[model samples]
Structures are given as C-alpha cells and as structure tokens.
Target: MALTIAGCTAPPVVAPPEPPSAPNTSADLSGIKSYLLEKTGQLKQATRALKETSDRYYALAKEANFDYTALFATQKDEVIGLIQTAREQWMVASPLYEQMEGIVAGTPSLAEFDMIMDAGASKEEDPQDPAPIDVTLPDGRVLERPGNLFGVTESTLWGTFEAFRVPGQFDFNGDGQIAFGESLPDANVLKGGVDALDEQAGELAEAARAWTPTESDAFTALVVMVPTMSEYFDSWKNSRFVSGEASTQRDFVAISRLADIQDILSSLLVVHDNISPMIRGVDTAQDDAIRRGLRDLKAFVAGVHKQESGGKRFKPEEADVLGKEAQDRADAITGQIAQMAARLGVKIEQ
Candidate 1:
C-alpha cells in the first residue's frame, strides 16, 4: 500500500502558482495626463505670444498717431489674425482637454465641475472709424480736429487696443448689430471669451488644491488675469465715440453736451474696478447676477435724461468746469490701471 501511494504522488507534482503582477501606475494613465499637461503648456505659450504680438501692434499704432477710428481696417486684420491663431490652437488643444477630463472623471483628481465655453469661431473686426471733432469757444475760436473719436473710434483706437485688442482674431460679429454677419447674441460676446478663461482658472485652482504649486499656480494665475484684461479693454472700447456732425454743428453742442460725455467716461473709470473684480475669478450664476447688476448700474448712469443732478441744471460754465474735473479723474484712473496691469505682466501703452 505504501509503495503504491508513493508512485501515484510522484506522477502529479505541480509547481506553486506565480505571484500576481503589480499594477503599473504609469501605464494606466498613458496619454491623458500627458495630453492635459501638454495642452496647458500650449495655452501658456499662446498667451505669451499673443501678448507680444499685441504689444507690437499697439506700438506701431501709437507711432502712427492717427485718429482712433482711422486704423479700424488695420485693426480688423490684426484681430482677425489673432482669432484665427487662437482658434487653431484651441482646436488642437480641445482634444487634449477632453482627454484630461476623461482621465480625471472617475479618478481621485476629479474636479467639482469643469467646462469649456467656446466663443463663436468666426470672430471679425468691426469697422469702427473716427468721426470729426470740432469745438467753438464763446468768442468763436474754432478748434477742429479730424478723426478725434473715442471708444472703438480712431482717437481711442490705440488705447482700445492697449486695453482689449488681443494678438490675432478681430471679428466682432458677436455684437450682431454692430458688425456684418449672420445673427448672433449681443455685441458683448467678446466678454464671454474673457469669462471662459476665468472659469478655466478656477478649475485649475481646484486641481492645485490637491496638486503642487510650482506647476498649477502659475497657470491658474495666468488664466485668471486674462479676463481681467479683456474686461478692461471691452469697457474702454464701449464707452467713447466720435462725432457724426460737422465741427460747426458739434461746437454748438460742445458748449452744451460735451460735459455729459465727460461725466459718462469718468463714471466708467470709477466703476471699472468694481465690475472687474467680480468677473476676475470665475463665471457662475452668482457672477452673472453681479454682471446684470453692473449692467443696470451702467444703464442707469448712461440713461440720465436730465443734465441736472440735485435739482440744479449743469450750466454751461459749470459744465465746462465739471468736464475738466472728469477729464482729470479719467487720467488718474487710466494711469493707475496701467500701472497695475504692468505689474501683472500685462503690456499697455504709456
């Protein structure tokens, strides 16, 4: 019996099973994290490139010393280029972004919320030119300056660029009524792009909460600053305008109407900071509400039918003084914003 059992056991000796393989962390996240990190780098590079191009354009524009509206055609081309470049880059980057989302979706790195708000791809520049400026003194000394317009006009053209013009795309068709194109939302769609960047920054911020500072911190700061810049530029462009009538006609109103305009511009400068901070971080339901409130305030100030405040008419003499004061305030505001932007690595003309 012992001899039979020994022979049977010798016939079926099996090797111990091999130990299970360890999971490969690097192999599991092969393309996605890499894609996200790469795309993020592209965005950073594009931002810097766009800023440089914009600065160059602005320098050339300032040297021209032309009216605000005069360079509309040139600016249109410049802005269009900017948009095209950005679009191409984004097109390439979107997939990477999607990949990032996929990798982060079921993982520990998942964001509370993430979205990418794309602006209309077909952005174009508006044909905003300078209108004539003519003012007459009480003694009838005419001061006539051609193409001295504000906002999207020639005089403010450079300043507008300094404030809002990006390096490439310029199609302003988003303001459906302002430019030629198919139907769209309000002319304020440009603001949405700015808002989108801010939103991305917040997501990046959340990512940073669990990640390290050296990598995510700079990117988030860059993202947040983009909207801040766009807001400044958009406000500047929308606030000023040039004359439609001849100097002879404009002068009569200058004695009567210029003061009101000065007040409007000054008011814009005052509220700039208030509106900017709200949009500087992220776009949310709350931010939208704030935006609506700000818009209401703007409309209220802009829609004042009467020149009188506190039951007193702004007499021509008093209006002139007020105009001067407003101008001084505007200068101060512009100077301060310029300094702050520079400190933040934004390039604005002196």
Candidate 2:
C-alpha cells in the first residue's frame, strides 16, 4: 500500500514560463542632430548675452574714470549685476563647450576656438602688458588678440592677480595682499578683458552654427568627453578649489565650480539620452547599466556644495574627497559609454 501511494504521488505543479524581454529599438539620428543644434543655439544666445553684459560693464567702467572705489560707489549694483550675469552665462557655456570638444576635434575649422575663448592663462612671458598672439583667419589674415579672456576677467573680479606677484598692476588697492572682497581691478583693465571675451564669444557662435556632427564623431564625443570631465573634476578637487598656492587664496570659487559641473552633467545627459536608443538596441543590459551610472553620477554632483566657515571656501580635505568621488564616477561613466561604443562598432580614439 505504501509503494502504491508513493507511485501515485502527484507530479509537482509546473510553473508558467517567464515572459520574453521586449525588443530593443534604435534611436533616430535626426533626434540627436536636432538636440545638438538646439543646444548650440542656446549656447550662442547665452554667449551673446554675456557679451552684451560685458559691453555694458565696459561702458560703465569708462564713465567711472577707471577708479574701482568710485565705480563701486556710483554704480555698484549695476556693475555687480553685469558681472553676475556674465558669470552665469559663462557657467552655461563652459559645459556646452566641453560637450562640443569632440565634434570640434572632428572639424578642422573649430580647432582653435576653445583656446581663443577660454585660455586659462595668458601666453606671455610677462603677466602685465602681455603681447597678443597672432591668430590666422580663414581669409589668411592675421588677427592679434590676448591669450586670456575669461581667466583675466575672473582674476580681475576676484582681485587675485597680485598672487602672480605683478605689483601695482592689478593691485587696485594700495594693500600688499589682493584678497577676496578687496577692490576690483581698474575699469580699463576689466574693460579690456571683457572686450576679449566678447570677441571670442562671437567667434564661438559663428563656429557652432557652421559645425555638424557625423554618427562616428558623435560616438567619439561620448567616449572622449566623459574621461575629460573626470580629469576636470580631479584637477578642481586637487588644486583649483583646494587650499594653498593652487587655489585663489581662500576664496575656493566653490559656487562657480559646482555650477560648471551641473551644466556639464546636463549637457552630457542630453548626449546620453539621444544615444540611449542605440545602446538599448545593441544590448539592453548594458543600456540599463549606463543609464543607472549616469543617474548616480548626476545625483552625486548635484549634492556637492561649498562648506563655508566665516566665509565661502572649501577645506582641502573635503574638496579632495569630493573631487576623488567625482573623478571616479566620471571614469566609470566613461568606461560604460565606451562599452556601448564598442558594441556599436564605433572606434574611439585614445
């Protein structure tokens, strides 16, 4: 009887088969092109706005007899507002410029646009009264211009040029130190910096309008850009925003750096979203991983803020941690994107 019962034991109920995964779809190339065009248009507009604001600042400076104290006393609000506006525009353009680097690299015409617009330091043997570089135009004409635009403007605004040991030059005040909250550089000096920025902005806009990106170039952009971003964050963390001689005294420029990071991530997200369909079509698992990684990186970047004590500044230790985390995340994203590029049979150059 026991044997009969054992043999009669009912077969285990079979579970229903799992559902098949959805088919992946490739992204429309037209959509990506449209996004690029739209972003470039925005960048052009922002740069133009920045130029106009700078022009207004220059005009005000001219009227104020180039005296920092008199300028602040008479048109403090207007001057400060213009500077803030120009800074905001720059914050918007910086990331767009980075995003466009790969495309620019692919286009010979845009080769020197970045250096012209945002050279970090003047390429002169002497910081004061530095000679202008000669840039050959498309028509084979030479245009002489200062190497530093944004950098010079920033230095003037923060009164940090004295750190360069160029005494009595950018030192608007008689004090030995060019500390934060000190008097700004003379109106003429700031006006010249603003003029350079204005000219370069115009050139950038013209270049952006003429440039176009191929599919291969777009893929290369994704591959190259992420790693470049990691490098930028690493530099910022290690030196640009840190304490000691590397930084702008104790000013840190934390807000500016954070804003730039935010803009950069936003631009990268546009590229990611546009290319996501292609990634999904090639490999759904990889696509998911890339999206997740970018999302995490964005959240981490957004969370970063200046920790001020007495005033706005960054502690070296704290900046180092933040910078390391940002760099690591950027590197991870770059690797993940490169995987997608590989799957798509795109060759990314070193």
Candidate 3:
C-alpha cells in the first residue's frame, strides 16, 4: 500500500531513535581531593607534634616560676631540645601546607586559612591584607594581629622581634657565640603562638577533609596560583637567605623562600595534573604545551635550588632578574589555562 506504483503518497518510514551517550566527565578531580586530605592529615600530625613540644616547653617554664633565665640555667638542654623539636615540627607543617595551598588558596571557602597561615601580613605591616587574629600570652600581653601564624612563630622562635623574645641573649647552643635564634624566647609567647598555629592547622585539616574539589577549583588554582612567582621572589630578595647578614626581615629567615616557591608550584602542578584531561579534551596541543611550560618553570626553579644547595648564594639583585623571568613564564602558562578554562566553560573563581 505504501509503494503503490508511485501514484499514492508514500507512507513515512521511521527509524528508531538512538540512545543518549553518556556524559564525558573527563576531569575526574577526586585525586585532588584525596591529595588534599592526605596532606592535611600529615599537616595536622606535624602541628600536633609542635603543640606537644611547645606545651612541654611551657610546662618547664612554669616549673621555673616564669624565669626563663632560671629555666635555661637549670634545664638548658631540655629547653633547647624542646625548641628544636618544635622547630622540626614546624618544618614539616610548613611544606605540607604548601603542598595543599594551591587548592586552599584558590577555593573561596578555604582561602582564609592561607591568609592566616602563610601569606597575610600583620595589621601593622599591611592593614589591607592583615591576618585578623590576635594572640594573647599568659602574661596578659596581646599581640595585635601580629601576622600570619607562620610569621609569628618564626619571629618568636628566631628572636627577630624584641617584644617576642626573653630579656637577653643566651648561648643556648654552647657554641660560645649567640647566633640567630640563639636567644631565649619568651615562653608565654612561644606557647601561645604555636598553640594558635596548631589549632588553626587542625581547623584547616578538617575543612580540607570536608571540601569537595571541582574542575573550577583545579582550573582556578592554576590560574590564581601559578602566577605568584614574583611575590615569592620579592620575599626571597628581601630575606636573609639571599640578602645575607644585612637582611633585617623578621620572618623567612629559617627557610629559603626559593624552597617555598618550589613547594607551592609543586602543589599547583598537582592541580594541573588532575585537570589536564579536561584541558586536553578541549585542546590537546594546548594541554601539552601547558604541561611542558609548567615542568620547565619548575625545572628552572629547581636549577636555582640546586645552585643554592651547592653554596651559590644568589645576590638580591639577581633575584629580581630571576623573578621577572620566572614570572613571565608563569604568566604565559596561566594565560593558556585561563583561555582553556573559558573554552571549557570552567568558571575560575575570582
């Protein structure tokens, strides 16, 4: 009836509809979440160690009736030992935080801790970007937004700020000469600062556990974090690590800023790796170029680190040159990521 010698209108022949294809879900960023949690757990453990050692120090000081001189006179080795232990814990906690900072600083909900822990200046130092928390000591002395926890602890332990130090210098190391960080820290201040840091670290760890990362977070982290080389280099230029004995900075003396830069970039690299598939899906050539550029940037920093390890102290002037070069590379890479994010409709959080 449908093909009646072309004299009648042909009945329509309909093909069945095909099933819908599955969603791409190309960027499975669960690894980023896992990485953050794993590192946060490790950071919490390190902070706990610092807290324990700090408490032990404070307990000994209390036993000495708040006389640090008396405490050091009678228990020099224990005091030094506790201080060293706290320092070791700080070393661990710092890099662990750096490893998580790409995610932490990029996410809106997680960004405050980055301010309180790492990048925020003191109210006095930078009212615009000051860390808004204050520390209270046992003696009722209040540090009015004295800076980021890391800065507070570092300055307190190193005796860079006079208010955070005990009355006089001590040859705690028995080297016959008092060097940097050789003086007795005011125990009350030490305990307060480290305790605050430990508390905040614990909070950050919990927050990180609760955070579910998205492609936005990964891409935003790359865009927001990858171009920070200039600031880090400025810190390195001003720090004693590069400025030598003439440096007057209160913080960043205990560790090289170069090392910190590498740690931070290493975290951003993790963020990129987790989202590379999405980038590749959008533009394979661009993804490969970004990957290569990032690796090269990191390798450039690594080259500087290797030189530092070999005792090649970079002049402060040289840091400017290096910083500019690194920043240029970083800016280029970030631009690619930003363009790709736009193409993929990934919203980079402001």
Candidate 4:
C-alpha cells in the first residue's frame, strides 16, 4: 500500500522479511552423547572379553614354558577355543566402535583414540594418522606405534604378522586343511595389545563422560568426517574382501572394509538427523538434499557390499572408479552443508 505524505510524497514499497535461521532450541545433542556413551559401555564389555581370552592364551603359553610347539601339541583344543573367542570379541567390539565413530572422530577433543583403536596405520606403513603409542612386547621388542590396537591384535591372532606368528600351520577350524590366518599367534603380543586396547576403551568412555556435546561438535562432525570416501575406498580396494588372495592387507581382512564404511555412514546419518531441524530453518531444500544425499551414499556402498557378499571380487582399478563416484557425491553434499553452516553463522571446525 502507498500513502501520500505532506501532499506530495508517496511511501515506498516494503519487501517481506527474510525468515530467521536461529539454531533450533530443540536441537539438543544430549541424545548423541548418550548414544556414544551407550556404545562405549558395550565396547568395554567386548574388549573385556578379548582381554579375558588373551589372558587365557597367555596363561596357556606360560604353562607350556612359552614354547609354541609344546603348547600347540598338548593344548590344541584350548588354543583353538581361545583364538575363536578372541575373534568373536573383535567382531563385536569393532562394530560398536564404528557405531559411535561419528561422534568420537568428529570431536577434536577425542579424535586421538580413534587412531589408537582402529583407524591408524602401522609403524612400517607410517600411516598419516599413526597409532600414537609405542608398544613394548614382553620379549623386550618395542613396537613403535605399530598401528591400531585392533590391527595389532588382529594381525597377531590371525598370524598375518610374521613376527607374531607361531611358525607352524594348524587347521584352526578343524577343516583338516590350512586356510589363510588359520595358525596360532604370539601369546605375549596378543595379550599386550588386547590389554592396551581394553584400557583405552575405558579411557575413551571416561573422557566422553566428562565431555559435553554442542551444536558445534555435531556440525563439525558432519563437515569434517563425512567426505572421507577416497581413503575408505582405497582401503577396500586393498583388502582381502575386495581383492581376494591378491590383497596384502592385514587388519581389515577380519571384517570387510565395505561393511565398515557402511556402518560408519550409518552413524553419521544419525548425527545429521539430530540437527536436521536446525538445517531446515537455514534452507529447507538444502536440508532435504543433505538427507537424501546421505541415504544415497549409504545405498551406493550397500550395492557394492551386496555384490561382494555374492562373491564378486572387485579389481583395484574398479574400486578407484567407484570411490571417485562416491567422493564426488560426498563433495557435493558437504559443499551444500558447508554453505548452510556459514549462512547460519555457525562455526565449523576444519
């Protein structure tokens, strides 16, 4: 509407105000913290199981005077049981960790444990994120940041590391033939690594208890952790699950990298879901796009996992192609998210 003022002036038109995008008061991240703590609690249980099994293996070795040949000859059944139990515990604990990685790895205050637990590479590999501790073996050999606790324990249990192997083949599954990673491991190495991992799991849970989750932490997790496709795909390409016998990798063999990637993305999806109301205020269209994008990314990996489960081994080159496609998708989605964060005046940690 226009109005005349003082018999000659006309009032100008006014545009509608832009909608506010204040942080949603309901965007409480205490749920995420609760989920993290719950998972860590379960992880503690699983690692304790590993610790107990490793202790048994250690005690058995000690009983036989640390002689691998004598231990295996007399206590074959016991050794087999301990190895199987340890493997089962690993399967449980690793996924529990993965279920909470979005929170743990995204928060700067707690990212180091991710390296110590799963993501770090070996001393020889000199991984970009190396496990930050040097492990001193019982025999006086120091493993200088020899990798993640999961990897060290897995390699030892599965006989993947030459230094940790028992130097004799045994059909652990009673299949009457030797399979890959079917032999015994060094007792001291297994016990030491598992014990360290168990302790760290407790420490992580303690830190989580002391820490609080903020909108900043949630957003930072999404922005920082969600676009890591190429690195994950490279690992999948080199793993035994994707490369079969040609794979020279060790740790990820116990569980397929594809499975791990899917689990990780699943957790990230939960993180995004929690802050979705805040994102919607900033831009409804973008909020929906990010949501759909996350589902699509997980589905893409799920397709590959289905094929792998059906016994289709992907060549290394093929994995690179798939990885690039996923990377491009992730880049686009995160780009939209980064823009939204800036517009909302939210600070995202790089």
> TM-score for each prediction?
0.27, 0.67, 0.92, 0.90
Worst 10 residues of 4 by lDDT: 1-10
lDDT of 2 by residue, 1-350 (tens): 99998899888999999998755544555654565566566666766776677667767766765565666766767766766666667666556655554444333455465555543335443465333444332224443443445555556555566532123332224466755434444445555555555666666666565655455655666666555545555555554545546664322242445655555566556667777777887687887887787777767766664333234456766666777887787788788888777767766654
lDDT, candidate 4, 54-136, per-residue tens: 88888899888888887877888888888888888889998889888877888888999988888888767885657898777
Model 4 CA lDDT for position 160: 79
- lDDT for model 4 comes to 0.85
Cα error, candidate 3, residue 88 (Å): 1.5
Off by over 4 Å in 2: 1-27, 31-33, 43-53, 56-111, 124-148, 163-179, 238-246, 249-254, 306-314
Give candidate 4's TM-score.
Answer: 0.90
Q: What is the full ranking by lDDT, best candidate first?
A: 3, 4, 2, 1
Task: State the displacement of the C-alpha of residue 85, model 1, in Å, after optimal TM-score superposition.
Answer: 3.1
Clashes of 3: 0
Q: Tell me the spans in candidate 4 whose CA falls farther than 4 Å from its real position.
A: 1-26, 127-129, 138-141, 173-177
Stretch of 10 with least lDDT, candidate 2: 163-172
The count of backbone overlaps in candidate 1 is 26
* Model 3 bad stretches (over 4 Å): 1-26
What is the Å distance of residue 43 in model 4 from its true position?
0.5
lDDT digits (tens) for residues 1-350 of candidate 3: 55676677678999989987643536888888888889888988888888888888888988888888878888889888888877778888888888788788878889999889887889988977799788888778898889999989888887888888888658976878988788777789988898888889889888887888888878888898999899899998998889888888899888888888888888888888888877776578998999999999989998998898889989888999999999999999999999998888888888
The alpha-carbon deviation from the true structure for residue 76 of candidate 4, after best TM-score superposition, in angstroms, is: 1.0
For lDDT, candidate 1 versus 3, the one ahead is: 3
